[model samples]
Target: MKKYFNRFPHAVRGITYATGNDFGFRTQVYLGLVVAFIVFAIYSPLSLFEFLFILLGWFLILITELQNSALEIALDQLHPELHDSIGRSKDMAAGAVLLAGLFLTIVLIALLLSRLI
Candidate 1:
């Protein structure tokens, strides 16, 4: 337990550095917060399931963004010079994040329409 607890500081430091220095990560976090606020405001009387779904969607987006940033940083450190394969890998990582965002958007829209109509 002591050994496990010792790693907490390093984990915290890594998260702090990544979120503080990464533009994409910060942007996604802000966007998620804004969306959460809008959804909660518009749908004040949310059911348990609806609220859970909203939280899940935002969590998925943030998870994907973190993964994308990690992959890009690792690739950059490994291959400072631009290469076709590296470019493809980065593109795929970005695509994954975009797909997650799109799915979240669809879910949000459905939720909003369900409430409005």
Candidate 2:
């Protein structure tokens, strides 16, 4: 158990690096944090499913951002020169992030409507 807990700092460092290096990742984190604060603090009487859904939505966004940023960084390192294929790969990764954000937004909206109803 003690050995398992030692990896947290590495994860934190990764977060720091990503936050510093990727503007889009940072923006997603900030917005996700706002929604997270609202859902966890202001929202009331969350069912298990709703809580899980919220967590999953946030996870999906973060996961995609990490993937997208990592791809861009690696690709840039591998081929610093501009190329059409590399640009297309980056664009598709970005598109994935956009789709994830839309899904998260839909989840948030559904939760809000549920609270109202």
**Candidate 2 residue 49 C-alpha distance from true site, Å:** 1.1
Which ranges in model 1 have alpha carbons more than 4 Å from their true place?
1-3
lDDT per residue (tens digit) for residues 1-72 in model 2: 877789888888888999987898898888888888878886776889988888888788888999999999
Tell me the number of clashing residue pairs for each predicted model.
0, 0
Clashing residue pairs found in predicted model 1: none
The TM-score obtained by model 2 is 0.79
| Candidate 1 C-alpha lDDT tens digits along 1-117 | 999999999878877877899898889889989988887888888899988888888788778888889999999999999999999999999998898888888888998889779
What are the C-alpha RMSDs, in order, of all predicted structures? 1.5, 2.8
